[model samples]
Target: MKNPIAERITDFIKNYHPFSELSYNQILQVANTCKVIYLDKNEILFKIHDEIHDSFYVVATGAIGLSITSDSDDVLIDKCDEGDVLGLRPFFAKDNYLMTAKAREETILYAIPIADFKPLALQTPAVLDFLLQSFASNTRNPYDKTHKGKLISENVIYDDHNNEIQYYQPISYSTDPITAAVNDIVQHVAQIMSNRRIGSIIVQENQLPIGIITDKDLRSKIATGLYPISVTLDQIMTTPVITVPENLSIAEAQMMMLKYNVGHLCVTKDGTNQSEITGVISEHDVVVSQANNPGVLLKKIKRAHNIVDLKLVRDKMTDLIQHSIDKNIPISHICSIIGELNNAITKRVIDFAIEKIGTPPPSKFVWLDLGSQGRKEQLLLTDQDSAIIFDDVATENHENTKHYFLHLAKIITKKLNKIGYEYCPADMMASNPFWCRSLSDWNSQIRKWIQNPGDKGILMTTIFFDYHCIYGDENLANALTETINNEIENNELFLAFLGIDALKNPPPLGFFRQFLVESDGEHKDTFDIKARALMPLIDAARILSLHMGINKNTNTSYRFAKLAEIEPQNALIYEACNEAFLELLKFRTEEGLRNNSNGRYLDLSNLSKLDKVKLKNDFQPISEIQEVIKNRFQLTYFT
Candidate 1:
């Protein structure tokens, strides 16, 4: 007689790994002895230091959270969802469990008896190898080479084959740095560099780095007749060398190169120029370490002569974002790096646009990146929202001046779209007649929005208020920002209106912690992450930050952090909102990369239970912060 339950178990396990590697008859035999167990939400299956059980478990449905308890908190490092295997520690070792396993939601698991599977595993080479590899993966530190493959106190670090983890790993710079003294002949140093096939050599005195010389310096100073090759290194080498401490990660190294516009960095004992030089990181070395990384892509962006060239670079940036997200690099750091690249891309597009028109601007102007680009929070290539502010012109020349800038903006925006950034659907872009205005016109425009913020005014403030000058005339942009802030000071009602808007989208979670998903339309049954989760935090931050006259911090997370400092009584709430915003931003970026869309709408049913739990954990701050906004603005009675 056939045991239908055992046969069903074999069918499910066969679809997954290790079990998938086994023969059907073999799996059915192991499954016949298995027992089924069900758990309520947050129910613990096994815990740290608990005696090993006779059976290892497989997640049949829902999700399981595997975590390590430290002195401070429990860190959920890994999740096992449908078909995911856990509780394999008992099969590898007779020792107690090192990590705790708990059901993140209502869950059903299949407990496969070790006695029944061990004999089957020994007979199958594939199954035996799979067990050995899985057992070797449990460790406290994934990067630690010595402790690389052993169970340590039972927390597991999932192995990554894509080299994503290298983003944070310490870069291996050349410790035995080749150096030259200030008195060394330029010709002599050049000979040494060429002999070693290296691009740069440090200039030092008293064993401390003073300056550096690279191939560029030689070509310009010697070959171009700026200086003679017979001169001493002191007269030719670049002084005040850029210095960084040892163990700088690859991401940081790339950012440092971009920030300083240098091809090499000297590594000192201490992180300053005063310390002795220990190692050197050249552009060649960094490029070799991570091919197709930020340094390479940024260089490609700068050198691009055609629209197609920049498009290819933008596509590579997508790959970079994907890698950064996978490696779990701090979202803030990733934002800053990507923001710089985007800024560079936009600036290059503007340069090409100006050149295409074959003429310079009629007046000094500033290209403004409004909305997410302005906040430096744009990780994905979504819609572009921008504005333009040119210098005020004489009455007779106003129309002509505005026309020139508008044409320039049109060219820039079109090229941006051709590269990757989609044109904003609502036409809230710099090319619009309303957005392309003189500095004086913008001042008047912002004043009207602030002084009389009706529905239209309120909506405009949200779209246009956050501004970052990407190219040209920084002073023009600053003058406009000053006016917006000043007008906001006298308009308490505008703040109230903005506050009312902030509460429009309450925290997304409904009663019993179910996601409040869309009820109709093409996005029905999907969660509007942007509208329900991100906007509440963004709107509240914008209103509060403007009220406090905090002009420098435009990024939402930084705004909340600044709010925490100034409003100490509400520090905890503000701080939590900051963390919450970062988490949500990271979550959205991850989803966007996975589905190749904006990642604002999420299919609730497709998400694993553990992911839903993670998302819900971040929603609490949104509720508490909204309450703070409501009471402070007194919006309860405002009509």
Candidate 2:
């Protein structure tokens, strides 16, 4: 039977060349056996040096980017839009793909089998001519001269070992770096950095780069009283700075930075400290060169002046997350990068809110991210759960101080809402008077929750205990964490309630080892992966850490890692829990990207046999962890 979908794809591609050379009947015959592939943005169709697929591709819609990974720099060479042919080089050359073909946007591709197309090409003179011309010119489309050399541009260079050599094109740098003399006072160098809105200033002696002083140097030295403001640049600056040649490529610069664990590099006449400084390249420069890299997205988030700019950057982050998943990057690594980016975005939103309020907080305040965000495991966009803790004011001026912060919170949450973070459904946000409070008030609220241990109190305890300070005073956040740990140290009742909550959803598998899917709800017949699988691990980590007087480690994986270190008796189980948590997170993130939803509810029917098995294997750790939590807290009495 003829597939209607393949016919529709054929109808679309038949309007474009070399398919255009065939009759409707002939094209339909070819399309019947052709495969249709749907790709999310940033998804790779074929990677460099990957085995040649049996087919070549035509973009039916959206765009495909042909990129070359030269010296760790994935340089986008050409963009193939609708009707554009790609991956054909493999067909003509009988070798592995030289360049990667990635979806630049949500794309649909018609994968025409090369075996079937070859016969049609021989019969159709026009089709034969198009293929020969394209192959001869080393171009995807011979008619388009605009990207003539792009396909074969330094993508196939070979070394003596016959290994493909990655090309490293020189990158642009800031030639005029902000500099200060070696004899300049710390105060003066600080002034230069502030005026230029830069983080580091190169220290020079006789027009040669000598040392470097960054914001971090000042924070750790001057602010910490290790060095005074009157100290000379020669005293405070880091000596024998790392240097690269002026003609350094983006990939090489990134390598040097990573090798040294430094953020800034001096571009010199020669690639050594002995050479004169010609320019400067920072990690930011390397990041900006790659549009889809997480660092670039983070930099963009920081520079975003408005919510619209932030929205665009958030969109890019989505693509970055998708790309990371497609490459099978470790889930923990992906979480850390996305988590940092998310926090940065939240902090930027707060900065914008402060700007809109036309004034900074009247007193010192710290922004608190609650629940999943506090744990730093948020991969997909979801509701906002945040609060503010300002310094205590005089009894007479308490309401006025509260009003200032509440107003500030209102602005921030609204801005975040506009940028795609939905308002907390329970009103557990800064905009709520109950959540936005003075430091003492927050401390008291937590005390009440810990001391009382009621259902609502337990709920609040769960939400607030994982609180991470997104911005503001670190001392204030540390003090709050200290207070919470002190309150829970002797509270056996509180630990019991938390343990009871942790076991609410038992392991996802039933006695027969069948998935215990939701029987009925809006997500009928679907597996509640988040509520059942992920939350059990999160709850166990939190309660177990609380019992051991561990605070401030909100992330489940991090908590488990810490647990493993401290509890070597059960270290294997803790490590197993950590791996299970990561795998579940990866599964949920991939599902979320695939369905464009929260990935909370997973359709069991949609999963492959391998996916089902992988998910099933993770359940044992959840069961084991819950058993440990139960015995530790003596939760049998509570239930």
Candidate number of the best TM-score: 1
- The residue-by-residue lDDT of candidate 1 on 1-639, one tens digit each, is 899999999999998767987889989998999999999999999987789999988889998888764221354656777876778888877877767899999999999999889998888876765565454444222233443322321222211222111123345579998999999999999999999988899999998999999999999889999898899999988888989877566655665687569999999987688999999998877766565465566677788898898898888778777766665656775676677678879988999999999999999999999899898889988999999999988999999999998999999999999988999999999999999999888888888888888999999988787878899989997887788877888576888999998888887888888889999999999988889999899998998898899877588877898899899999999989989899989888988998999889887777798888988988899889889888988887752
At residue 119, what lDDT does model 2 achieve?
90
Error (Å) of candidate 1 at residue 58 is 48
TM-score of 2: 0.57
Query: Where in model 1 is the C-alpha error above 4 Å?
Result: 1-289
Alpha carbon deviation, residue 156, candidate 2 (Å): 28
Clashes within 3 Å, all models in order: 1, 0
Candidate 2 lDDT by residue in tens digits, 21-114: 8999889888888898999999999987788999988988899988765223355667888888888775567877767889999999989999
Report the C-alpha displacement of residue 399, candidate 1, in angstroms: 0.9
**What would the TM-scores of all predictions be?**
0.58, 0.57
Report the lDDT of model 2 for residue 543: 91
Number of the top-ranking candidate, with lDDT as the measure: 1
Residue 310, model 1: Cα distance from true site in angstroms: 1.2
Candidate 1 RMSD to the real structure: 22.4
What's the lDDT for candidate 2? 0.80
